[model samples]
Target: MTDTFLIGMLVLAAGLFAVGLFGVLARRAVLFQLLSLEVMLSGPSLAFVAAGARHGDPAGQGMFVLVLILAAAEVALGLALYLRMARTADVTDSDSIRDLRH
Candidate 1:
């Protein structure tokens, strides 16, 4: 593949990042925000893989794998916390989870 293809992949990944950002900012559901955050994380991971392919270096691929693992851990922790919150509260809206004291 040529540099154009790699650049295209990067552009596509950037688009995904932007969409994910919008979802995180615009969505009301905490779960939806978390899902969007994961997508945002994965987009860069994909970009890293594409860059690694272009440069013929395994480091980028290794970083991508590490990021995947980190994303998985993040989802696991986030889901556990979400489940706890859901059990205690009837709402899952991100805006409604404010428990901070005035």
Candidate 2:
């Protein structure tokens, strides 16, 4: 792997992360936020893979696996919360659910 390739990969990772951050902050819908969160997670995952490939190290790949596990857990928990919120009340906007207590 060349330096230019590494730089490009890093830039791409940054872009993915930034887009995800924008989605999470700009959108209020729970589903969109979840999707954005996944995108955000991907940024680091890609970075880890790229770096690992560049350095010929397995640690980066290991980290990527951990991130994947984290992302999966987060999705499961987030969806459960979203479903619960949806059943109890309107879940169009996140602000409305400020107080989970019914």
Candidate 3:
């Protein structure tokens, strides 16, 4: 691919990351925040893959795999906590979950 392709990928990745960040910060819903966090994570994965391809290095692919594992674990744990909070505390509101700071 050409430099233009690389730049385009980078721009797309940045856009995705920014949108995800905004969603996380602006939304009060826990599920939406989790999804946004996933989107944010994907942005860097795209950048790393693009860079690895551009440089003909395998490290980028390896890093992406690690990120995928991390994302999976995050989703699993986040959902578990969300469910626990919803069931035990009857809480869906983030502000009400301040007891978690303990």
Best by TM-score: 2
For residues 1-102, what per-residue lDDT tens digits would candidate 3 score against the true structure? 999999999999999999999989998889999999999999999999999999899999999999999999999999999999999988786777787678
Q: Global lDDT of each model? A: 0.90, 0.95, 0.93
Model 2 clash tally? Answer: 0
lDDT of 3 at 49: 98
Lowest lDDT sum, 10 consecutive residues, model 3, at 92-101
The pairs that clash in candidate 3 are none
TM-score of 1: 0.91
Cα lDDT tens digits for candidate 2, 1-102: 899999999999999999999999999999999999999999999999999999999999999999999999999999999998898786757878786556
lDDT: the better of candidates 1 and 3: 3
Residue 84, model 2, lDDT: 88
**lDDT, candidate 1, 45-64, per-residue tens:** 98999999999999999999
Clashing pairs in 2: none
Q: Please identify model 3 stretches exceeding 4 Å from their true place.
A: 99-102
Q: Estimate each model's TM-score.
A: 0.91, 0.93, 0.90
